[model samples]
Target: MSINIDIRLKKACKIFREGENISGLILLQTNSDVKHDGIFLTMEGAVNLQLSSKTVGIFEAFYNSVKPIQLVQYTVEVVPAGKIPSGKTEIPFELPLKPRGNKSLYETYHGVFVNIQYMLRCDIKRSFLAKGVSKSLEFIVEDRRPVKKTDREQSKAVSFRIKPESLQNTRDKSNVPRFCISGKIDSLSCRLSDPLIGEVVIESCETVIKSVELQLVRVETCGCAEGYSRDATEIQNIQVGEGNVCTGLAIPIYMVFPRLFTCPTLSTSNFKVEFEVNLIVVFEDDYLVTENFPIILTRH
Candidate 1:
């Protein structure tokens, strides 16, 4: 006989804010009647961290520092020791979404090296002779606090100009191509729900422009008093311009922050999550020039 288990959330989006209630149902189906023990449902949230190859050796000495951090954990018995009827049976459940004691709930984030996740699991126990069944469903958690007016008022727009003289870490200034790029970001503080807005103009260039692109980067740091490992990785790259054409035309910069892959900037004693944006200009010769802008992300 075959048994199947499915978990469905009342909210189709499967997204809940902090302090909210996670309401869902557990559906069990089996071809034939089966005797079992008890049915259990668990809700868990955690932050997992892993060091990159280069940083692994440094952290190997302090392995326990990188262990998964349990933010929340709760288990409840959905059904007492009994037999699940054949055909189909539905069990409804409601779990309060809160952090354990002194711990806090962070937004759900899926990243390399560092990840924060929330999940719901259902387990069906059977007799010693029978096989057990279990299922897990992932959900997203968002911060519930509102953005303060002071923070919003502090947001400021940034204007920048990029030229060879402005470049950093340039080995030979003579070999560097001549180019003048100017742009303005609407604001350094960005709301998660809004798109990053900006515009760039290529005023003059000695070489043909091949492409202009935008790169979103995530900087994650994990460590302890012994040491710390910080890694920066690209989250997404978008092409805003292609081919050598008008020199003075303004190019618009627009990018919607990808969900799950990004969350509000976070910092704690154990770790931190930050974001940055890079404007890249590629020449016909494949030589590239890049300008970096650190940004603060928030959910207002």
Candidate 2:
């Protein structure tokens, strides 16, 4: 009996993400068409690091060191029946990862490595004599390690600052406010400590509202003149003034609401007119990167 063969591996090298399946193909061939008994494959893992050090005086300062890690093994096998013609084919297999050593150097890192050495054992029986053929394949497995502690610790401790130094509100003498609402953010901090801007805004309609005293009330519950309202509201005192407006007040704002008078509702025309202001603020940190916002209102 005569046995001729051709053997090749899909790749002499392979790579995998831990926990993912490691797979590849094995190619086998026969010459002049021969009957084959079966096919089987197996793999093993090994890790090694070689280091060199210095020598001092007459004695060797340090010796060349070699570290050999543990080995893990895996195996797969498949058999083809009856006589087969000479050709080539693939045998696919998988590799499942089990956790390695627990120490830092023992632990896997971005470049941690594993070497896979494999063997394909073929046992063929023909006529009165039996013969076996085995082949070898070598592969490399690399670890794509996750981020470590040092990187996370470096991202905390944020700082902030406000620009321009002054916050201003400019308004006109109309029923609505007459001014520009502007301010700058210099410093703001959060638990993560990343310097940032939290919340900055001009209350606009809700920012600052002035109240006038109600002189009297009308029977028509919804449209009475300034003097015709259910509430008697008046603001006659201002402790601090800024740019034609009061910055601080001692007057109890609740005392100026429609509730105090319990009279008819004021004219809807007053409510129909909306207040306008330019809301301007810059949100930034010590680094100077920022988001600039603008607030504008147009009356048609």
Q: Going through the candidates in order, what is the number of backbone clashes in each?
A: 0, 21
Q: In candidate 1, residue 224 scores what lDDT?
A: 84
lDDT digits (tens) for residues 1-300 of candidate 1: 888999999999998998899998899998888788999999999999888788777656447778899998999999999888899999999999989999989999999978999999999998889888999999999986766665576478889999999989898889999889998888878888999999999999999999999999999998887888899999999999999857889899999999999998888878889999999999999999999988888987
- For candidate 1, give the lDDT of residue 276: 95
Per-candidate local distance difference test: 0.90, 0.31
Give the runs in model 2 whose Cα sits over 4 Å from its true position.
1-13, 33-38, 49-67, 80-85, 99-134, 151-300
- In model 1, the worst 10-residue window by lDDT is 145-154
Candidate 2 lDDT, 12-69, residue by residue in tens: 4443334655455555566556665656555544434222122122222112222344
